[model samples]
Target: MASNPPAPEAPYAPVQPPTDTFGYGGYRTDEGPWEEWNPTAESIRPVRGKHRVAKQRGGGFARSSTVLGVGVIAAVSAGGMASANTGKAPVSISMPDLPGVGSLISDDKPAPEAASALASFGSEAAVAVDADADADQSVADAGEALRSRIMAQAESQKTQVEVKAAAAAAKAKADAVVKAEKEAEAKAAAAKKKAAEEAAAKVEAARLAELAKQYTLPTSSYTITSTFGQAGSLWSSGYHTGLDFAAPTGTLIKAVHSGTVTEAGWAGAYGYRTILTLDDGTELWFCHQSSISVSVGQKVATGDVIGRVGATGNVTGAHLHLEVHANGNAEGIDPAAWLRSKGLNP
Candidate 1:
């Protein structure tokens, strides 16, 4: 038989529970070297696969999901930043469809190389953003300049229009003034012409009145029976050669002007007639007289009674036939005209 195992020790040792070095129970009277050491990542080693981190119930899975979600959010935010840097609209990022939830939480740590690449990308994106901003500012400045130019041109045009309007108004005002002045001048000239015409008329009237003062009619109450040059068969001449003044049978006839009696006789056609010669060599013949009052060769004043009118030879009524011989012409002139020449209207 195999040697029997050494005799078992006697059961005198007391049984003891497991000792706890981690101090979970509470205080420790003595401090260890581990307490003096400040643990750094370089000094500490990560737990191997054999060791596992302990967690509360249901906490480990939730923490892993949260970390995964944060990583996805960071990636999407980086993409948005890239779009903004490129001056493009931001695009929505969707999570890739993974076959299992484990894929989302598989790796929590990022690689060193990827982190360096993200840093470089961020620097380039910043440069892109600055360039975009500069371009945008340039465009805005150009637009502002264009707007300013348009405003300036509009202002210039408005000023020109105003100037033209002002000039036109001034010209119209000046024209109105000129027109008023011309109208006033025309009215003044017309008034002056009328006044001159009236003055001339007054002077002519005065002259005619003075001329009329020197003239008178032959007899006061006599009526004109016939004018000179009247066509009649009663006279020896075909036309009457004297003016006939009808009166009563015993009416006095007067000398028309200051003259000398040239003849007082009964001619064939004139019975008991008289003739007078004026200082101007004009002869006056008074026929159809009833009787003669002045003798021949007698000097007589104007208006002296020379004869009385009666129905004498070749006369149909009591009247005086007066004839005027201008400058001793045989053909007798019209007595009416001769009287008018001496300012007497027959």
Candidate 2:
């Protein structure tokens, strides 16, 4: 605590830690925090602890930097190797659920469960489409059958129309035939009526002509002395064959009727007789003629000078013997009755 003593002196005066060079030849200083001790090159000197600081700043700092660089290089190499091997980091996606996720990515990716379900639906759609196509075909077949039946009906109708037309034509032909037959029958009836009328007219005209052929005696002084069929001894053939007209001589026997004298000749058994043939097949005899003015085959008009009458043969007295015969037959009908039927009486 209190005893102080004098210390031993260094041999060379312990070099004063080099005097701090001052002035122009010493340290440099300023108002900054660190000051320079030396100002000139002459006063420059080394510091005492410089070596130690240099050592620490040199090798020790270099060693530590190298270590750090090596560590960085290793880290880069590891990163490059990991990139080359794996290509990229694994990615994760967010989705709703497995139940509905396939419906969202239908354009691109397909999940396993989703792909199986799609295949099943495709097969079912194909079957449904096939069934629809078959149904359509059946419908088409039914329509075709109906159309064929309609066409058949049309053909049958056309056939029926043709039959009706044919029947109408046949009926028209029959009607024409019947009409023609009726016309022909009517014409025949008309012709029959006309012919009957003509025939009746002709017969009536002939009757009138016959009536004109007969004439009556002017005087009712004559009688029939002999008949055509009177059988007696006076007749040459045991029959009174000729008609007789007994009248007084010079009885005006003007004319029997208006007729030409076809014959004016003598007849045997009628001496001095004159015969007059009329236009008809009738012979008129005027027997016992006093004279005859007409000759045979002479055409004489009625009331002409044909002859005069006289009893010249087989007469009881001078009486006119008149006889009438038809077609030169000696046996003749009653002249009076025949003349009455012709509208004349004698």
Candidate 2: misplaced stretches above 4 Å?
1-220, 303-305
Per-residue alpha-carbon lDDT of candidate 1 for residues 1-346, written as tens digits (9 for 90 to 100): 7798899866332222125311124444352212122323475465468755444232234334334454555444344444444556555445554222223323455455444433444465566567678889999999999999999999999999999999999999999999999999999999998999899877766765665664456676888989989998988888899998898988888888878999998887787789899888999998878888999899988778988888888888788889999888899999998787666777
By TM-score, the best candidate is 1
Per-residue lDDT of candidate 2, residues 77-108 (tens digit): 33433443445442222333444233423444
Off by over 4 Å in 1: 1-208
The estimated TM-scores of all candidates read 0.43, 0.35
The global C-alpha lDDT for each of the candidates, from Candidate 1 onward, is 0.71, 0.58
What lDDT does candidate 1 reach at residue 190? Answer: 91
Q: Give RMSD to native, each candidate.
A: 18.5, 36.2
Candidate 1 clashes between residue pairs 3 or more apart in a chain or in different chains:
none
lDDT of 2 at 229: 71
